[model samples]
Target: MWLNAILGPVSSPVIWVPASDTRKAWSSNARSSAATHREVFCSQGIFGGFMLGVKSISGMAFSFYDWEQLELIRRIEIQPRHVFWSESGNLVCLASDEAYYVLKYNPDVVARARETNASVTEDGIEDAFEVVGEVNETVKTGLWIGDCFIYTNSLNRISYYVGGEIVTISHLDHTMYILGYVAKENR
Candidate 1:
């Protein structure tokens, strides 16, 4: 039976269990003082392949897990106010209070995870992701507009990342917050 798990109340660690069998659940300690969000992704060709993301006071972190052994393989850090995986899941787009970043998934980490059985703490996996690009701007929220451009909601304007720089695409007089966005095509 497939299972569904609910995460948290913001200031605690995450607990997850099979809906039908609560006794067989798995839990991991919180990475920071306050926990904000979590996400799961696949690690391409690794044995366990599953990776988990937890956002907290320290930063956004991704932890690799070995399903069969139920061990944490490693943890990688990405400092962003918000983060989203691309449509293809090969890239991650991030929005910080003062900048935007794009990161490509690292296959080397998977290879290392497969070769080593030794576990790593959250602070150990420092070099897991490669930065593809960045744009200096205040990003309240952001999305990957195709594979090249990024659209972000700033304080009172909509900005975009193009040609390695941030360019304002639209402006507004009133303050606004962008929660989410959708990218239609590769451009």
Candidate 2:
């Protein structure tokens, strides 16, 4: 199922929804409140491999849809600060404020979604897939190579996580980004 973004500056509302088989993008009114002040924030979302996601800065909202088909994968009120994917896009690492979660993507979820006519969610997604692992660490930066997720935490320590455990850890002199991995020399 596909619906357009509920986007607007809190005025003259317009809903972006699918027109027959074609989807359109338009602005919609933002739902407001005293605490929130306004609604529907947008940002430069994340894109990697075949996935793209619109995640707000305040961690209030997010939506990930298919770039080509415009299929809605999910929509929720909270989003991770960082999301990293394996080269195959089958494994994912979701870095939140307190912890990072590793999840396995079910290839059949999309097919099952077309059947349910609903976007998948945790409670009723029924895809038989879920978070595979979690570590109580806030990752500064990380990258995925095969089954292991290598990341640096606030302690400036580089740790390799695989199979639900931290397999290795080493202290770093300074902060740096993980550009890529070379298997032959093993860094």
Candidate 3:
């Protein structure tokens, strides 16, 4: 699913491109949410496909792009939900009120996630974000007094392994998400 949003003048329609050999995907509601240029997050499926999270006019819309007979999966009931890609390439969506849910398109990963918790530790933990034991950099896992959260803004490093990289996924948010340190920086 190759959905691209081209920011033209101001009323440009959002286009959805199908990822198929035939390239036979139509654009529905092209002018949907033309008022605001909302950022769309793409998540890779475990079954060799992808899902699109777009801020439609109605609300936050999730739909399958490449799969057939695909309809809108879920419509987030938040005015402005925070959605991002998970470590497994699944969609990690969260509402402003802290309603966290993962829209998993990967059957294999979803099956595993459902059968067992992805946490490496065996202490009855579900959905644990693990930091591999091989980093030698300072990782800020707490907020200081009057501290800002964004990685670039707060000058902090968030290390999460995904897609063959230790990408900085979570920033700081004293109110919403909690930051935790897995291990100390190697000396």
Candidate 4:
């Protein structure tokens, strides 16, 4: 059956349906925690299309769905205190209580995942991700600035990542926190 081919033996419950496309549905598994917030983001790329659905709290996981085919491409386990996407949707920045991560979107992997019903394994996820940088103190929040990310750390300092190196920006007496930042005429 077409449904079986798309979703496999395990059926997914419909989470939301776009107003225009009733035939195409969005679905997810039962969330592990009620306290955690769930969010879905969709974006188009050169290979095809994809979406990121984040289940925050308890057992946190980032589930990537093939947007064009409407299939769960893969799932990656993450424990993030906070998560945010780049304005271009090309990067996902997340921070755990003790660390920070910037995950670049992989169109090649998305294409590979589209070829099979089986989800990508954890090893595959690791292979796709590159640890661009790390921090000793907890990362409070982060925002994308061009090809780099500016992260606010627990020490009231801002750390910047560009070209695989981290630059720390500190303040003497003032408590520095990122309320908001703008890039290239209101993006």
lDDT of 2 at 167: 57
How far is each candidate from the true structure, as Cα RMSD in Å? 8.6, 9.2, 13.5, 10.0
The per-residue C-alpha lDDT of model 4 at residue 148 equals 75
TM-score of each: 0.52, 0.66, 0.30, 0.58
Model-by-model lDDT, in order?
Answer: 0.49, 0.61, 0.33, 0.52
- Cα lDDT tens digits, model 1, 83-161, are 6556555576666677767777765775575478333344543345667787676666556545545454656787766
User: For residues 96-178, what per-residue lDDT tens digits would candidate 2 score against the true structure?
Assistant: 78888887877687777768766556533445336788788889899988888998887788888988879547787988667
- Candidate 2 regions exceeding 4 Å error are 1-41, 116-129
What does candidate 3's lDDT look like per residue over 1-187, in tens digits?
2333433333333333235432122134343321123323332211122444444454443333323323233343333233343334443322233222333334454346536645323222222222222222333232211111221212444434322234565555542333432335511
**Model 1 regions lying over 4 Å from their true place:** 1-51, 56-79, 116-127, 176-187
Each model's total of backbone clashes: 0, 1, 1, 0
Model 1: lDDT to the true structure? 0.49
Ranking by lDDT: 2, 4, 1, 3
Better model by lDDT: candidate 1 vs candidate 4? 4
How does residue 79 of candidate 3 score in lDDT?
A: 37
Q: Which candidate achieves the best lDDT against the true structure?
A: 2
Candidate 2: RMSD to truth: 9.2
